[model samples]
Target: MAAPRVSVFPSPQELGPALAQLVAERAAGGGDRFSLGLSGGSLVGLLARDLPAAITGPATTGPAAPARWLLAFCDERLVPLEHPESTAGAYQTQLLPRLPGPPPRVLTPATGLPPAAAAEEYAGQLRQAFPGDDVPVFDLLVLGVGPDGHTCSLFPDHPLLQEEDKIVAALTDSPKPPPERITFTLPVLNAARSVVFVATGGSKAQILKRILEGGEEQPLPAARVRPASGELLWFLDEAAAKELNIPVEKHSVL
Candidate 1:
């Protein structure tokens, strides 16, 4: 396994802009489109602020705007688009409006189904959106770690951790509330071209320590998120990095 590179920032404001710049750079390269998977939490709010700042500029005379990119959810609650807990709803309310152009292609699950059906529908959506000889490689994936080290709704000590065949599955009994959710399985998550974990707050300090230095046998879910050949980065704040003894580099945008 490769060593984890942790980037410590003083605040989310600093980390968010850095992440947005990285995404823009990745998307700038020639490709059909950039596929980005996002997670919901306090992380989304920070992204809302940073992404617009990075992608948009002062209004100026122009013939046309740049082509919009694609946005997909790495995991989503089994709720309607209008539901309070809907991940897509959160992004629409927070991130989409601020972005320039019509809107990115937002992929979401077919609503009004049972959890299992909804999960299968989402998996089908992914397969269609990213058809290939093998698993689709996401351009970038932004993730958030729960206090218990869960990422993309995959909780530690759950049976979902052992899933291997399916690329996505319905989680019916998440340790956290709002149990019904659909998430990308480990195989799909590890296939991403880049995976970044945005973890902040002192509440996450202990778990961050465990994930970084704890033995593989006592692994946390966040510890298992290794990309096939892509880069893995952790954006942490001082409070969150408090218990981590490993050396972390400070980032500067200037």
Candidate 2:
């Protein structure tokens, strides 16, 4: 297990821009396809607040093709894209306005289909976007950690957590609301070039301790998100990092 770089911020407000800057820098490292996977919750709201500031002017003018970025969800609810709860809807409404140039190609699950079928359709979309039919390695994945220790739509103790063959899978009984969702499996998520977990609030403190530290009889789903050969970063607000021995927060950009 590699040590994940931990950046503790004084507030969620400050954390967002720092995270967006880190993402922008990574995207600037030269790639025509800047693949990014987004997760929902306050992460969407936070990015909505600060990501646009990071996207304007110099960031998009660089060699990296932010305009051609491939945007997709780490997990998305099985509902119409117009629905308030829809992950795709949130990003479209909130994050899209921040981009300085042409929008990234967005890929979403066919929400009209059955859960299992939707998962397959999403997998097909990934295969079509990425050549050679191997597991898709996203250039960057921005994720959120649930208090229950879940990431994407993979809940703790869920059967989908053990999914190995499929790049995407359906969850019909998510411990969270809406019940059904389509999510990237561990194979696809772990294959990402980089992953950043943005966690805030005191509600997340306990699990952050366990994940950043160690020693659980069974690892939580969020803790299992280890990239095979890439960087993994945890951007934590003071409330979220409270239980760890990490120093008290002062705002700083990575």
Candidate 3:
């Protein structure tokens, strides 16, 4: 596995724009369609605030628009679409309208269905969206790490962590709220072209240090997120990086 690139910013204010710029750069780089996997949390606010500006700003040139992107949730709470905890709903209301063009193709789980059925249906959606690949390799996946070292709905010591066969799995015992969710398994996560973990706040400091520095026998969910042949990155603010002893690139505009 390749070592992750760590970048620390002065604060979230600085981090947000940098994150948006990185997204714009990746969107401009290659194929006709760019597939992006999104994990919700504070990341929604950050991307909602900056991504639109980054793509529409006068400084931006080329075809870096979001119109051709395919956005999928890395994990989604099985709740009503209008529910406050729904990741897909958050982006629909907060970020989608802000973009300049028509909009990206977004893949949202069928929340009205039971958890197991939702997982099966969503996996089918992924297969159709990304034909020819046994496991869809996203162009980029933007993720976040919880204070407990969890990412997506996969919590510490959870059975879902052992999942390998399913590209997406459902869990009713998530340590976090809502009790149920569907998430992309390690196979899909590890096959991504690039994975960027954005973490901020002092509350995340200790876990960040452990995830970045410690090499445990049973790695934390966040730590287990090593993309097989893809780039892994950690975008942190100083408060989140305060406890880290590893070398990190201080932020400068991308």
Q: Best candidate per TM-score, number?
A: 3
Return the TM-score for each candidate structure: 0.92, 0.95, 0.97
Model 2 RMSD, rounded to 1 decimal = 1.9
Choose 1 or 2, whichever is better by lDDT.
2
Give Cα-based local distance difference scores for all models: 0.81, 0.86, 0.92
Candidate 1 lDDT, 22-118, residue by residue in tens = 7776766556677888999787788788777666653111221225466788888888878878888899898888877666788877757888898
All candidates in order of TM-score, best leading: 3, 2, 1
lDDT of 1 at 13: 70
| Per-residue error (Å), model 3, residue 92 | 0.3
Better of 1 and 2 by TM-score: 2
Local error of candidate 1 at residue 228 (angstroms): 1.5
Worst 10-residue lDDT window for candidate 1 reads 58-67
Flag regions of model 3 displaced more than 4 Å. Answer: 57-62, 252-254
131-189: candidate 2 lDDT, tens digit per residue: 89599989899999988899999988899888999999998899899999999999988
Worst 10 residues of 2 by lDDT: 245-254
